[model samples]
Target: MNGHSGNVFVLSAPSGTGKSTLAKRLVKDVPDLDFSISFTTRAPRAGETDGKDYFFVDDATFDRMIRTGGLVEWVEVYGHKYGTGKEWVSAHLAAGKDILLDIETQGARNVHGTLPDAVMIFLIPPSAEELSNRLRSRGRDPEAEIQVRLDYAKHELCEYPAYDYLVVNDTLDRAYRDLESIVLATRLRRERMGDTAQRILEGF
Candidate 1:
């Protein structure tokens, strides 16, 4: 690990945990933060651009990327294949941009397995009841599916300790600040700070 090495941050959470909302807020608060646009087989949501929210591709194209090793990590979720492209992340990292990846727990695990030095954060809801409420509030998914998701969220929360940091999303503003602090602190690490690392060592 070196100061100049690009950082890869893996953010994981269950559906309705407010990971997306918190991530958006974090980027708005952090000037230099870059959100890695993921590749997906799912259709774009309303107002989401092709390259901005996700790289929309067919299943065959996604499979090709998988075979050709174009993705850093990929996973199938909710019947769609989603992945982060390696080139895009490497380019941003090489340019010294702090990148944040909003992904599912399985995808986060895959990224961690490959990029062990990367920082991993898990966002948690206040409770299972709150998670269900949030999901229901969205007005999506059938009752059966919502129940399924609630069950899945419970299982996902059990992996909290595997992450470098646990951010409870009771309040978006507070969670954003906590996540920003984590990124700033990580950037100050000796391995990532280079000359600053030497200066700190000298002072010590």
Candidate 2:
């Protein structure tokens, strides 16, 4: 990791909140917005491609990554591990690229601690009932596992105060609009746009 700029945008949500879908669409539509594909200890779900959806690894490899400082932020959820790699993010940011992290609440906190300039957003479902319904629609987790996720969500929701923005994923398109607005707005801040403004001022 070299001189990192810490121009990171982090999105955190409980399971079934549509965070992953939004993050993907945001990256695709936004210029200079790179998706930070995370490392995970969980087995790949149906339709999840390795190195695309996630870098799935075993426990030993994950532990070694933790020990060697390879991860920027990592956390254990539902007995599985998830992490963002340090080198990838630092390299991108150092090269003047913006990165979007789709992560859990704990990992978001950790990233904020490291990159104080990073923007944090929390995405939530419209209601607990809807949250449960979305999980069911995925058909990835069994009934008991869904219940476990819901219970964890109850605890995770308490961390909303830590986020800079809150997006309720009631409608996919509308939520994306709000998310896009936040990112675009952040880019216009003086800290980010100062160089461009300075050059224009000098020309004048």
Candidate that scores best on lDDT:
2
lDDT of each residue in 76-134, candidate 2, tens digit only:
98789999999999888988788999889989889877778889999999999999999
lDDT of 1 by residue, 1-204 (tens): 344756778899989988888888777777668899999999988888998778999999999999999998999988999999989888888887788999888888888776788899999998887889999999978999999999889888888878999988887778788888898898888667677767778997
Candidate 2 CA-lDDT value: 0.90
Counting clashing residue pairs in each candidate, in order, gives 2, 0
Show where candidate 2 strays beyond 4 Å: 1-6
* Candidate lDDT (C-alpha), each: 0.86, 0.90
TM-scores, one per candidate: 0.91, 0.94
